[model samples]
Target: MNSSQTEWAEAEFSRGWRLILASAFGVGFGSIGFVTYSIGAFVDPLGREFGWTRTEVQGAIAFGVGLGGFLAPIVGYMIDRHGGRKIALWGLVGVAVGYLMASASQGSLGYFYLAYAAVALLGAGSGPVSWTRAVAGHFHGRRGLALALTLSGTGMAAIFVPPYAVFVVENCGWRVGYMALALLPMVALALAVFFFFPDRSSPGGAAPVHARTLTGFTLREAVSSYRFWLLLASILAMYIGITGIVPNLIPALTDKGFTPTVAASIQSGYGISLIIARLGIGWLLDRFWGPGVAAVTLTSPVVACLILMGEPSYATALLASVLVGASAGAELDLLAYFTARYFGMRNYGRIYGLLYMGVALGAGLGPISFAYLSQISGSYTASFQVALALFAFGGMSILFLGRYPRGDFGHEARPA
Candidate 1:
């Protein structure tokens, strides 16, 4: 190659870390929101287009959460043991494959469910566990922001994917919408692997020599502990309420007599709120008492539920979206930062993987259970009311976390 070409390639490699960071976000935007939350807006439309039932339509989401739940810890362990880039890249490819499979369902909702769920497992391969691990490895000083920014990709996807999905479905047809979602993951995979991946190393620019997972599980020790369960339950409840209950929101709202457009608009606000809240929370988490801040912020959905139950005021709906969105936005950062502080990092993937199973179970149960509840109760009001109480209890429970360790993290002995 010519000298100029060589220099250009060198410069590109110099910018490799930034590219990797952007790739994390890009893949997130392209994959999760598009494939997961945003799929809701098209739920009703796709059901109509393909002659499917609401239960059948929402089944796809339930399946993905369940799949993610089953797979997350394993994927998390892989992330810690292996690395983030390859797993995430493959995950995106799986997501793309899911989208394509859903598109090819020939109007069968069950086909979408099976396809989307398969993609979801692939997605679990590249989910927050992997991304957060990657970012956590790269920055010690900006760990909070780095984690926040990486996880924020899901919210970014949430922002555009739902409304965008609806638009694609309305204009081009449901098949095209699925295809669009399918195709976008290829871009994420390409950017992630080639231009935007991280090196195996530490923040001081020392190459990361892989750490072994600490062995010997002592359930007796784990059960006796208060904070292990505290952090676990806190993170778990947040995941379920946000991922499981919230994604079904627009559909729930529409079932309550709101127009499809209005539902889509509310969903969009939910998406936008996450993007705004994530950056804001990232800034605040560094300065504020994260748990206190979390306590206050986590109550959004309870407040949102109260707002939602009133006479369908657009303002109230907007507030609900904002609260839910903000909670979802900052949640992973809260858990990751807090976990690293309390438990230490050597077993980060292993510890987090186990913790994430709570998330899986909660998330797995929340949607499917809510769908059945929706059927029995004949409205989302009661189900959301129950979720609201859970959010409130969880929000208030943050005060109890005062006894655990806090402050910025540095190198420490791994938890046994």
Candidate 2:
């Protein structure tokens, strides 16, 4: 081929790959951020339908997360060995089927439990570990922002899912809510089959077939490293602080004397902050160490939680909610990006898979966890105080990450 023809063909291939990747990104948007995110909104409906207590309904949510956490290591190992396409595609199948099952659950708690277990299995397949590893394989230079943009599915989900779920469940019934969720995975599956790059990248920049398992470090090697443990600690601290307060935000604010409507509105405001922060964090990640970006984003919650403590008025609650939302919003991106950078994308799935279990674990404990703190004192006020402390500790811990890990994905390491 002539130079011009070769150049044209290369450009065409890049465009096709970009489309594939973007489509995969959308699939991810629906899978991780949308499906999992909308669970909380359905809790009330489940309670009403089954005559279950709030605590009982909360137990189911915890069960799903715990199940997901338990499954993470296996899922990560699968992705690391096989490439993300198959696992993620299969995940979509699970989600679609799970939602369908949940829709049929009606008043049966057993059915609800079974359906959510499927959803949790699906979650293990497509969650942060799977998608982040995909982005990590594709780019090293812009990996942080790349991870952020794809993971922004959560930001989009926070923006879109709740109100939609509320409208469906309030007017139509909870079953319809499940039916609506069923469609999301079809999108994921289509993209996975046609687009997800199912290979570890080649040095020549050509795509290759899914290959046999090549471990980055033996299980022994990983456990011996201090870095791995530190990263794990950071992940746990982050999830506990963010998920703990958020699940209870509406009640916490209402207890502080805000009306339920106002409390709900505060969550919306928080979502807006999170969306804005997500875009800003994505831009920043391209230029800075993810940990540096995390340091700023994580500490944001400390200020907000402290403000929350004052209960100065409803206004403080509103402001605090947004700050917390923004912090929580950007957090998964930080963890994902850091995993890719610190460890290398070669084994990103297995490494991050274990790390993401922290999120699952923290989520499982979010309700009972903070309640214990509240019990230790008197009320939500004291419990939130402990949350704020953890947030601060988590924020400061990012500083210990030292400089960001470096590599040549494509772009220069633009200074933040």
Candidate 3:
């Protein structure tokens, strides 16, 4: 109301955007840029060098992901108690070192698995769980957009990192490709964490002006609640259907008579659509009900699944890619936004970390499940039908979440 109050509020708003910007870069480079999207680029190279089966080479990643799921809750607790700034900074450095070690591998499966596991541990804090806490702590009215912008980094990385990894691999071999992937997180995440990441419990941390009193369930309470279980189950179901299907997208398209190049271009379209969908979903969330937006987004994948399974054509394939991308784009932004709205930010990091573990589990196992199904059935038709059913179920499940908790913004003090 007063001049001083107005000025302080404006300043905090500006600072929040800066935090989003830095976090965007941190996650883009740290999470997907180097790790998720880039990993596929190395699989062939690794196989070629070690004379290993595809499954054997991919096993290291699967092992790391499995362990990362277990690590999420711990990472969340640390962020709640210690803050994301220190965790991200140290974690990025560790990732860089881990990449270097990976580059120096002696073709030993044990060594490769160990190196990847270390990377998973150090890099845990660089994911959405770490930064979402900070962003949620800083913004509310505009929180959806802030998270959308932050998660856009993954879409950006998906568009560029694979090709970049291939370039590095072609010129310098897989060893150097691993090392090159290290630079983004080492330099960007480190600088961003130092300059922009906030510590909400600290005195000087930038917080939104209209900051509300925190009001919602604690971690124990959240786990005990039926709503939480429903939310988790919905997420798991959706991912189980979506994850395994997307990676085989190109192959599915090509088998329908499309050329490999055409299928590849449509796949690239999926990445571009992710960026557009994130921005669109973010804008909608600020104006509409959170759960509604999520439910609709989740349902889009059902149509995509159908299109892919139906008559094969360039137009149908492209349409399916965009729909799948929309579903993928909505996932993290919805997860971060809904978690804050439903549970509050008191223990946001830890709570989200636990939920994210569900995400990690789906991501790790979904593709494998689809592959196994196809292996047994001798065609992907059965797999696609199952995925379609899961998507519908997941979408409808969110409708029961009811109204998001509202009232206060700051964490309410709990009795010990």
Candidate 4:
């Protein structure tokens, strides 16, 4: 980049660093981070307590996240029209309440599912959709890096939440552990977002001097494009593979004869690799072909799937987790970067919301599918095989996107 371009990119962070920090915190504690990552730690505990099958235990995710996916587009439209601040703040509050409701469940599977659904419904705004929109509104030149930094919050959660959840469940019981998890969003995320996130559309909030003019395809135009459908399918497949594997990694490890603590410790490698991958992919996206970068980074997880097919040692298990984390790291960064590059920010929230619906559904379906398959086959081998194919298909699909359109900020082009 030219010196002028470098300075302009630097200035985005100089002025909007608070926005990035707040977004990262919000995302780390939001439904995707706290709920999605921590649910696995609870699976065995919940089953033991309630005498539920693995499928029954994991079914809550399917119900809750599926409902959340259904609501994502609506929430996106609201974010576009109103701004993300209010929605995110309210959503955080609701997420806290939902966790408390879940803690109160007394062995009723229906009640457990309802509580989780409430968490997803009420916490939708606290997810990546709102925060990424806010960040996208402000940063253009450094959009890829900014998004990677923001999304690294999930990596942070991945690093800390599983082991933390396991510790809490071991000492305080699963109910108290759920209650403790509520504190993350209720306190840290809500406070950071309330104080630091500057939504230009909000009352009295100021836009950055370098904020790009809002431009991009409308939701209708985006949906009609072949690229949009391709991206949606790619996201769906990738998440199915990722979510299916990561959440079950701990249980799978324990099944392979590791203790819960050891399993969680090994999973920490996944989180560390995720954080590194996000930053690395972000840097690469700004400098290379975005689709090519995505293809290479996301397709590496086939190795992880293969590694887990055997009773590997702890060191081998850690390697497998790292590979999985690397792929997980690429997902949201690619999603946000592609949406901005291909669709533009004109209808970003709505468009991204629709795409995020794929993530939500895939996340919801992945765990349940893994559990169901494992239950039927008495092993995770079938699930891993399925995920391997998904990783290959999803990773390669991006190559078909061809080149980005010629335009100022991706606003002036549309697919035929």
lDDT by candidate, in order shown: 0.66, 0.65, 0.72, 0.85
Candidate 4 per-residue lDDT over residues 237-351, each given as its tens digit: 9999988988888888888899999999988899999999999999999899999999999999999999999888999999999998999999999999999899988888889
Q: TM-scores for all candidates?
A: 0.85, 0.81, 0.85, 0.95
Runs off by more than 4 Å, candidate 2: 1-36, 106-110, 187-219, 254-265, 310-315, 371-379, 404-416
What does candidate 3's lDDT look like per residue over 195-221, in tens digits? Answer: 756554444354432353555678998
Tens digits of per-residue lDDT for model 2, 1-416: 45664464355345335423533354344334454346655655676667874455555556566677778779888866666655665666776777788889867777777777777776557666666665555554344555656666666556555566666766788889888877766765665555554343432222321442222444456557776777777777777777677656655665677654455566666667776787788778867667778888888888777887776576777788788878876788777766655665555667777877787777777655664565466567876777788888888787787764455322223232
Higher-lDDT candidate of 1 and 4: 4
Per-residue error for 135 in candidate 2, Å, reads 1.1
Which pairs of residues collide in model 3? 212-408, 212-409, 212-410, 213-408, 213-409, 213-410, 214-409, 214-410
Sorting all predicted structures by lDDT, with the top scorer first, yields 4, 3, 1, 2
lDDT by residue for model 1 over 1-416, one digit each (tens)? 45664464344335335633654465364334454476576667766777776666766766665667567668767766666656776777777777777778877656777886877676766666666655555444445665677667767677766777778887888888888877667766666656555444523221331653332224344345586688777766766677656667777888778876677788778778886787787777756777888888888788787776655677778778888888877776777776665665655666666666666566666666666677788876777777787788767776677744553343422222
| Total clashing pairs for each candidate | 4, 0, 8, 0
Q: Lowest summed lDDT over 10 consecutive residues: which window, candidate 2? A: 204-213
| Global CA lDDT computed for model 4 | 0.85
RMSD, one per candidate, in order: 6.7, 5.5, 4.6, 3.3
The deviation in Å at residue 211 for candidate 3 is 13
